[model samples]
Target: MIAPELLSGLPSTEELPCSDDTPVDNEDQNSLPNLLLFMLASLWAERMDWYFGVDMAIYHTTGEDPRIPVVPDAFLSLGVERRKGGRSRRSYATWEENGVVPTLVLEMVSHKPGGEYGAKQEIYRQLGVLYYVIYNPEFWQRDRHQPFEVYRLVDGQYQQVFSTAEADHPYWFPEVGLGLGFRQQRLGGIEQEILVWYDAQGNPYPTPDEVQLQLRQRQQELDAERQRAESERQRAESERQRAESERQRAESERQRAEQLAQYLRSLGFDPDQLPEQ
Candidate 1:
């Protein structure tokens, strides 16, 4: 619990800077979080009770210096605003956000080492983050860990919840109702390995662009089916019209033959005695 005095002394989010003026490890480090945010916006398009931060400072009073903050590569908080009170958040202060800490945090390791497996892990544990993920795409061998790792807080400790058998995709988190997994997907017109969100059935949640593509493909299929049905209907109608025309022609020929026979009888000649034409 935070002391009342400490809470009072904590700076307002607007008064603090949004970021710490440090650069991300690489483009992937910067884009991964944003990609997740975009995907969530489409997945939960109606809900406004969540906030996902990319490289944002999370100021908590738990540490020695309340002014200092631990900035995760990405962080997610439930029961928070899509925007802070319908306004952009300058920084995430636990006290300001109704004492809500991040439920999930992610860290991506790069060429230059960040302590994702060391100090940062401990910090997230102490902050009571329910889940911590470390994505070491480039330097996993050096760290002696897999490219993707997920740890769940259990009994006041983080337990690694991944095995070699499930290395491609990890277990689902019921709290968030999403799963973290690695798959090769196209982003920004490039196909590469990416960390993606999955559902309970182990289906990856598509990006906004992918969703659009899917909708378009479905529409095209529907249109094709409609066209096929119409073509079949037209074929049936043509066959019916041909049959009707044939019947009318046969009736006209019979009428003409009866008229000729009547004329032959009037002339005192039997039409049935004539040669077949």
Candidate 2:
């Protein structure tokens, strides 16, 4: 129902609303990798100077009803603004975006039938995607046992990347400045999870949440250091003032004694008021 209307009206990237941003549902804990890929795709896309729309699904043109929408695990749209007005979008409606769909599509194989691997691949190919990625860590095995594979459209056919290739991290594409690879990290105390990023050659890109946490910690340290310096300065000023006051008091006493001695001498009284023992 909503699909057909959207299909007929894909908007320009500049005119797109960030509120179109949709909240991803946590269908399973295993879906964590999917979330990481979606965000990393958007970030690397921005760094590479291309604008891409990620996630969400729309009616597949070949067979599915034009009025229905299908949500993808993650997808990438090239030629879109990497960051649109400094905000992420909710959903990607193709009709509103120049009729151009993702250049790359990735699916975390959970439970899609032959229809998905076959019809879905064809839909994306027909939609002009250049590459399709599948991570079947626990599902289908082509070489008898492997978790991931990338297929590049060569002459209108899918060419799978063998398990023994240099396509690992810093997975290079001439189009994007960054590389895509699987790495280990701690998330919610979970370790060694797969992540995507730009090539450090080995350096890591900071997650949005992690960046914010670091900023907060640095600010706290700065605040404490400033307060300490202020206290030390105030203490030093007070001690100087006390020392000056004591010197003045001692000078005043000395002057008073001299004046008394002169008065006694002028009156023919003993200059010393009390005789020394």
Candidate 3:
């Protein structure tokens, strides 16, 4: 557990400097689902240009009253500005966001069987979030058997999206420009990665690390080309030096022969006539 004083030094969740009435959310780490939620929250917060909050408390009322804080792993509000003024926020209250519920919500169930399935299932339905993701991934398979399910709230009830009859990928979140997949992703240091999304063409989105890798490779190639050009310049310089040296040698030999012929002519022995001797 985080120390009380340490938590106190961190900005209070309820306080948004812009407004005295914003509510705050408390952060906690619960289960495997929590991990997925936190990771997704990080991705959205890092990449997209939208107001996003993860595992933060959400209060209904401004500073006027106490808050009903629900900390979700990830939440996004499209219409809201990506960042406020110059600072980031601690929590998001729906009432402030034009009374909007989260555009998308994902809840990973704990190991306690049907309670999460039954209780939380009803809660999400009543809350009226547009999309709710449930990741059970066989936590209660043999012992209790609450099968893994993903639900899309259509009209009022959550219509089942993934079925046992035919295995399917997670929904394609067009807004984020990717489709969710359950494949293993090494990006987040998660070995058997679950609950990941893909791009429009069904290609896996590049992780941060992969993006860096490509940049490094390109830089190396540029360096190699530069080195090759430098080597070619040096070779050309060497060839020019050799040609100049040969020219100087030939000129010196011609000058010496001319001097010798002049001396022979001065001595009254014709240089051309003495050449045979």
Which predicted model would earn the best TM-score? 1
Q: Residue 48 of model 2: what lDDT?
A: 46
Using lDDT, give the best candidate's number.
Answer: 1
- Each prediction's TM-score against the native? 0.82, 0.62, 0.67
> Scored by Cα lDDT, where does model 1 land?
0.85
Tell me each candidate's RMSD, in Å, in order. Answer: 3.2, 7.1, 8.6
Candidate 3: RMSD to truth:
8.6
Please write out the lDDT profile of model 2 over residues 1-277, one tens digit for every residue. 1366655453443444433244443342235445555556546643544544335554334345433444556666676665444565555555545555667676665643333367667776665567777655445553243455677777878777533222244344445455455555655456644646555474556655455677898898898888898888889888988988998999899889889988888888887656778
lDDT of 3 by residue, 1-277 (tens): 2344534343444464323332322221233334444444556666554664555565543233424454455555666656544467666655444555666665554444434456655655666666666555555364343334556788899876753312235457665555655555455454544555466776655555556777899899999999999999999999999999999999999999999999988899887776553
Candidate 2: worst-modelled 10 consecutive residues by lDDT: 162-171
lDDT of 1 at 106: 90
| Model 2 misplaced stretches (Cα beyond 4 Å) | 1-55, 60-70, 81-95, 111-119, 140-145, 161-170, 189-194, 245-277
- Tens-place lDDT digits, model 1, residues 57-174: 9888778875788888899899988888789888898898888888899999988887889888988888889999888877888989988888999998999987332445756888
Model 2 has an lDDT value of 0.57
lDDT measured at residue 67 in model 1 versus the true structure, 0 to 100: 71
Off by over 4 Å in 3: 1-49, 60-66, 111-116, 138-149, 163-170, 188-191, 257-277
